[model samples]
Target: MTPPPPAEPVAAMVRPASRYRDSKVNRDLLGVMKGTSIGYWALLGLCVLMVHVAGGIWVYQVYKGLGIAGYAHPVFWGAYIVTFVFWVGIAHAGTLISAILFLFRAKWRNSINRSAEAMTVFAVLTAAQFLGIHVGRMWKSYFILPYPNQRGLWINFKSPLMWDTFAISTYATISIVFLFIGLIPDLAIARDRARGFRKGLYAALSLGWQGTTNQWKAHNRTVLHLSGLATPLVLSVHSVVSWDFAVAIVPGWHSTIFAPYFVAGAIFSGFAMVLTVMIPVRRIFRLEAYITDYHFENMSRFILLTSIIVGYAYLAEFWTAWYSGVEAEQSAFWLRAFGPYWISSWVMIIFNGVLPHILWFKKVRTHVPTLFVLSVCINIGMWFERYVIIISGLSREYVPAVWGTFTISWAELGIVGGSFAFFSMFFLIFLKLFPIIAIAEVKEIAIHERAHAEEGAH
Candidate 1:
């Protein structure tokens, strides 16, 4: 009789969905949406101030002319071009990790994909700024676009710049769409929890998403289609970027291997950037449970793999230069290692090629502090890599008389600093506004784990 009485409540017999919904992971992540701290505001203000400094420098340069920013005879493509290529390369890691890994069903990516995708979008935006700065006449920059004009001048279809324009624009558009599609379900969650204008905004962004089985099925199909489309862009955008240099007949630039070389370098720096951004984010947001040591180790392994590829590309370049018996090519390669910009070239080799091997040690990979420092060094090395490629190639051309050296002026330095500030500003704002981690995906994982636990109990 007592046993029968205790069997009373069906609610107690079956677990309520809320039990799974209010998981520790869900609660912890949702807490980030609550409000920001003083540190966030302080960092945001510092970023804004840095951006203003950059804007002031740009204003001064525009008024004072391009002379103020260190443009010269042979080295016209100085820091701006290097920074552009570096940022473009940085953009690759995001799409590769988010879209390609998604298509492969790499479950580990679920923790960091949102942040990586956001980084992709912002990096592209930052990279676009360099094009305007490099144009000198920023006002007439729109001329690069393919449109019917009164002057009857059209963009050259055969030009690599035209290809770059198309590739970057298309990649940015698809990336934005892919990022938004993934955000919809999470937006719905935010919409439900928020109040006032914030709620309405998220509601609009979420597009009336009600979590039904059919809706989820459609969502899954859409994601698969987008992922399939984005995967090639991950490869093509950076490869096309490499072609900007590769198509050139310059001794250092023209090589059949440049495409893969640039692609590998892009991935190398991109993962470094992800580590730079995510390490701090995971700590600040207390996302340790979600973005665990395991995630960091996985990324470290990726960094190690890309490092090896890049190292091979470097050796291959040297081998090609020496084996071809082309005096100019050999000279360019040797000059890169031991010429005027020798310091920068060796720095690139040591930081990008050699330093990352430290990640092979499990302790370095697992320790956040060590990984962060290594990641920063890798990014620095990557920038130097671009510098060596652009400056070294043009600095000592076949005709040494026409060759010249370039130094980055204060204005250009400000712009480079500003680009970093801008990227950080946007990413920080994104962290505060959106669920930085994917809540719905975390819930799905929790549900899967719980189901497995029940099966084991049986």
Candidate 2:
């Protein structure tokens, strides 16, 4: 038969860079976008219920008084302020992972940066609520803004509170813009695959993107510029927050070290919150291939580094207090370590400082359950850190007569719980509405990997 007419040489199959096919990627991710599990609905309903409870509590407080909560003499800044600082600190991790890491060209960030950036935006929103709540007169909260009004009133530019107003609003605005900008290509992907109202929603949100080369080029440039702008804001926002205390003349509050100390703790807690959110997300979405052990390992290392920094800050605070020879400062430091709130102080140390050392072990770093539990502990510890710094500093003034004890009330606890629910609710809604992963970016990485593989194959 003439050797089957000299059959043509079989073509070699080209392997894709990533294990996933583009169509499969779209299908898998779109599966996340399209449907909701009963569990998801149940969790969302629970969050909504908690949020309503919080709102009702806030309304009750508004009608009754701030006294219903825990605002008393010497402890004017209570659970609300502590929650605000904690949430604001939690916001820092997203910017650090997304903007700072992006600027450094960390490829590993591609998997988690989308969620981190979203967390930053929503955490800031959650943090903002406390400002109004703490002010007690939510209606008069607008007075903090500088505007041309019939009555001549202006924001005090020199006040740290004023600076915080600018800092947080600026951070929120820039973060939202950065998030929206980064999301365009993925939004386009969603737009292409979706139908009905979903298609139109994504189409509008995508801002007329057509995936042209020019569009990508412009998108990249904008991202770079925004990242540069955002990186400094991350440092500045928390620094300004620290100033809210550092500028005061309280025994523990006034210190030059507060800025860096607060910044480090912010990043520390922020990473913990990231871990808290991402571990469950990765599990639920069945995205183990995308969010692999490598990412968790790197994050654990980051947590370890921040833990060391925070521990140093803690020691430095004591050293500074002792070194300064200021009796009030010394008394404040002693009280923090051994006073009535000693349990909280030690809890902060154990959780933020000691427990994170477990991440130094490779096995612990790679273990998701351990990491999740550690992250939750870190979050709790960070909250207590804020409580120690704010309430402790304020409670023990030089005047012994004015010294008082503060306790969180049921209303405050309800509000705090509600804030968690609000944050979770918004994040869940985001997952439902958008691609949790950056489809274009992930595909781009895959293409680069494939190119390298093909070159090596030759």
Q: Rate the local accuracy (lDDT) of all candidates.
A: 0.90, 0.91
Candidate 1 lDDT tens digits, 245-323:
9999999899989998999999999999999999998888788889999999999999999999999899999999999
Query: Compared with the true structure, what per-residue lDDT tens digits does model 2 show for residues 1-458?
Result: 45566545545244453534446667776677778899999999999999999999999999988999989998999999999999999999889988899899998998888888899999999999999987778898988889877878667899999999999999999999988998999988888778999999999999889989899899999999999999999999999999999999999999998899899999999989989999999899898878888998898898999999999999999999999999999999999999878888999999998999998899999999999999999999999999999988989989889999988999999999999999999999999998887777788887898899999999
Candidate 1: C-alpha RMSD to true structure equals 3.3
Question: For all the candidates, what are their Cα RMSDs to the real structure?
Answer: 3.3, 4.9
Number of clashing pairs per prediction, in order: 0, 0
Segments of candidate 1 deviating more than 4 angstroms: 1-23
lDDT value, residue 208 of candidate 2: 87
Judging by lDDT against the true structure, name the best candidate.
2
Q: Provide the TM-score for each candidate, comma-separated.
A: 0.95, 0.95
lDDT of 1 at 177: 91
